[model samples]
Target: MGGGVLGTMHAWQAVLRGHEVIHLEREPEARGASVRNFGLVWVSGRADGEELETALRARELWAGLGERVPGLGFRANGSLTVLRTEAELAVAEVFAAGPDAAARGTRLVDPAEARTVNPALRGAFLGALWCERDAAVEPRVAQPALRAHLAATGRYTWLPGREVREVDARGVRDDHGDHHHADVVLLCTGAALSGLVREIAGPVPVRRVRLQMMQTEPLDEPLTTSVADGDSLRYYPAYRGVELDALNANQPQPAVAAEHAMQLLMVQRADGGLTVGDTHGYDEPFPFDVVEEPYQHLRQVAEAILGRPLPPVRRRWAGVYAQCRDTGQVVHRQRVADNAWLVTGPGGRGMTCSPAIAERTVEEIGL
Candidate 1:
């Protein structure tokens, strides 16, 4: 029952198609994976298969939405895939050599140029896979705007704090004993998909991956582009195979940071505060508690890369996502039955990929 990115994305596309869309959620507003995320609109840090096209198309949709829905954190600041190892560099190379990679604005960069773009990266990374077309948003600020836009759409009826208890062949029955109907029903439950949708019942291979992230106090300096390193690739399926294979293979032992699959993705806010993170955990039933180890690891990475410990952590927390079995990215038409569908398992690429997934869902329904 996430009314955050995917729900809003669905509402955006549905309204545009002149379809009446009722978005239901257990929370009054979105504060799940949509808000508890880096908000990096990553196009390149996506799977290299079918999602490539969806990401590309959704990118266009994001840009278009910016015209009417301003301040949705849709900045085109691009992304920098920091390469700290040979394997990471190799993955970047493959992405660059692959078809459509260049078009997506993925390019290999030298250390000098990389430093020129992000001075904080000095001496830490060898180079980076630069995605000049990527973008980011402040989740806190962006969610409000997205919510407002969806609300403004007359075709949209938001049912926040309303839990859907069951779904028969007809529609949904909520906890309040209120029944709502729709011609089609799509589950966007993130990690709770299996529990929410009975069709795919019983321990859907979706496991909850908890990640601890932190935001720094006001910084004198901030990285302009979003940045992630080898640990990021190993954890995020998007950048896993592209350029880091060789580097991951050579490491005699998994790097300590690798254990957490930690990566430093820094995004600067308008006020100069930087949001950085994150450490991955295969915590079952979703981890609401934030651990100190990840926070310590985050500091260590920042110190190693920037040659200094970052400012105080203004905010610290953990987020969870339902990871898919195969590609790790969510797919449309997950069920053969026309009305039933699955939209979870986005890994950490929800912000970048949700727009496309919602658009494709609209397309699939002939909206």
Candidate 2:
């Protein structure tokens, strides 16, 4: 029922299968985690097996969609996880040598090679772990562009600014007093977990995560690939090896970074501006204000990696998304009614795996 990436992708899958679709959005435009993210179709750091498979399939689907929808701005530029310390480099070595590392396109590059790949990164890092499967898209335009493409099919109808007030086995009723009926209904609500969702899902086994990020003015040069710091080793499941444990145990994160659960993921946009960020917050009663400490730490780490001062900050914001507490499950999907389903809690994997997730749903439900 929601119109974020997940919802839009579900609509795309259904309409492509010759099914009529009606998409609903609470906001005039999607301004949630979908738009607030790095537009990264990251496939490198996913957990092995099913999660990695989903990410890989989604990466291919994203490339295909980008070709059909020019506005998608998809790029197979890949990603580089910069390593500064010897410990971090050790972790990268282990990751590159793992059994599935070849499948993930994992490679280790020296500082010179890393710079050759992305000259914008002139920082003095030991080396970087390269993953060729990672990619990027223009999240700011993705949903609307997809919606526009779907609308051209004549079988898709978009209803924005319609907050679903009630949902039943037959259909859903919006706040505008309009009733829409469909054979199946999928609620792709992002982090809006209250009212109808709370009543139906009944204490979703998912937790909400809050994060802060910032964007800067266009840079003088391009960042050829998405970049991440060693801190990412702790956050991504793929790097949970003994080397990473040693690195984490030996080299604790800086106080400011640790305090905010910060990680440095930098990506250059189509316009040359850098999208950098992210500090994690999982507790309820999230702070109402964005603290400056995390931003300052991010700036320092970024400049050290780039070997240049970052451009002046142009925007700053915070976002929240539901993540499944059961790490084994990709997302929390429940049949709230005979024909109504609540699909959510993909966590940070939402953008990376939405297309594949929706495709699986269609297959399972025979939609």
Task: Look at candidate 2 and tell me the lDDT of residue 184.
Answer: 95
Q: Compared with the true structure, what per-residue lDDT tens digits does model 2 show for residues 178-214? A: 9999889999988888888998888888899999999
True-structure RMSD for candidate 1: 2.9
Per-residue CA lDDT of model 1 for 153-219, tens digit only, reads 6677878898877776777788899988877676678766544565555445556678888888877
Q: Work out the TM-score per prediction.
A: 0.87, 0.99
Reference-based lDDT, each prediction? 0.72, 0.92
Consecutive 10-residue window with the lowest summed lDDT within model 2: 326-335
CA lDDT for candidate 1: 0.72
Candidate 1 weakest ten by summed lDDT:
328-337
Residue 188 alpha-carbon offset, candidate 2, angstroms = 0.6
Which one wins on TM-score? 2
